[model samples]
Target: MGACVGCGGSQSPGVFVLEAGTYARCDGCGLASLDPLPAEGAAGALFEEGYFHGGVAGGYSDYDADGALHEANARARWALVERHSGAPPASVLDVGCAVGTFLVEAQRRGAQVAGVDVSPWARAQAEQRHGIGVAASVEEVAARESGEFDVVTFFQSLEHVPRPDRLLAGACACLRPGGLVVIETWDAGSTVARVMGKAWQQMNPPTVLHLMGRPSLAALLGRAGFELVTVERTSKLVSVGLVLHILADKFPALLGWLGVLARRPWLARLTLRYRLGDLVTAVARKPLAVVGT
Candidate 1:
């Protein structure tokens, strides 16, 4: 990976060369990313409907771990809600919300919640299980309603989008004034990333379109008309999901059981508190007034 000639930064073989290098760290805001995105078709193919929506079945784990992960994620959403409104936002949109865990929690907290995901399977499950409104694509959802959301979140999902700038812009357009855009993603500058080097799970060149640090993220958010309201390095190591993803990929036979183990009370507590393998959490807000509002 090397910088893109256009950006004078490291570049990767990915088709969208925002910069050079396997990843590019934005000097303006500290966002690091996989530049030269994988050929459009190749990357899009990886997210084939089935891979994301269907056949997830037993692959997700049996029971306890599933609940634990969902509950933990809910807690994260609740925290964001508190930061944004000292309470839940009246309306919310979760981009790439898998199975609607966060949206469910937000609903329970009194927010009128909706979610958008590309995976039909995931959408079905979220609707059936959580009773949340679901859309097949962000554009479709955004087009249906303008300035409809009080809070928009991309939890571990922003990195998957090909053109983050466009995505963020759309999100900005979808949100009402003073709405919040909360993003939770792998921190490319984390100690785990440095330690793991190329072996880092997020370094999976063609898939993770962008690997952002706080600076880069802030810059991107600013470019999209958001203001950095809060930024924190999650106490977690940021390696946990990557560890699980790797195990699932490299050792499929062990995936199911390991997913179960991930929920072990002892293991769960250790992971959550000790940062056994979590990463970064960031929150930004669209100002109640845009430049020309």
Candidate 2:
């Protein structure tokens, strides 16, 4: 990695390796990224049905099956945005929205919600599930209207993008003056990340390019023309079913115990709240006034 996507800082590659991918760190900002990052917008083709249903290309394993957990997490994230905005947002956008799970929840709450997902299946699902018309990207949404949304969110999506800074600037362009942007991604600099070292599950690359942290993410927000508001730990409520699947994947040796847990079908619907520091959220606001345009 010669340059950082988060802050455009110079980066040194070969700092480390995690799961068959070489890692690099920004010399100026300490942002870790995949060396020779994957092509931008490459994640589009990886979001089809198989991606969500079969865990293709590091995608989810039966994403829609976790609707309860998805809705719960969505509600939590939206509540955070509301707390910062002090009210329900007039309009909201979620970038890289796989199937509008979050937007459906927002729609139920009476907010005009929109989304951007490159997958045709996801786009159709968004409209069918919640009547939310999805754009291919922020540029497509900006083509129709700039400064149109009150809030924009990147819930667990930014780290996977090849050019986070560019996408962030586009997100800023989609926001009205002083609008808020909520970004929630994994933290590579957290204590758990350090302790786990290379064993950290999120360290997967090509699928995950940037290993974002509070300082690096703050810098990314600042460079994208946003004022840093707050950074905090965001909890994810994952169903026990998903947990068992992860356990099976990571520790095959525990299959005996995992099979026991999987035998209880009710556990599939049971959700566990994880308030891990490694999962971080940052909310930023566009400036009310610009010095130059």
For every model shown, what is its TM-score relative to the native structure? 0.74, 0.92
Predicted model with the maximum lDDT: 2
**Residue 153: error of model 1 in Å?**
0.6
lDDT of each: 0.66, 0.83
Top TM-score prediction, candidate number: 2
> What TM-score would candidate 1 get against the native?
0.74
- What's the distance in Å from true for residue 81, model 2? 0.8
Residue 140 lDDT, candidate 1, scale 0-100: 75
- Residue by residue across 16-48, what tens digits does model 2's lDDT show? 775558889898778898888878767777677
Count of residue pairs whose backbone atoms collide, per candidate? 34, 0
lDDT of 2 at 175: 96
* lDDT for position 142 in model 2: 86
In model 2, state the lDDT of residue 83.
95
Model 2 spans with C-alpha error above 4 angstroms: 252-264, 290-293
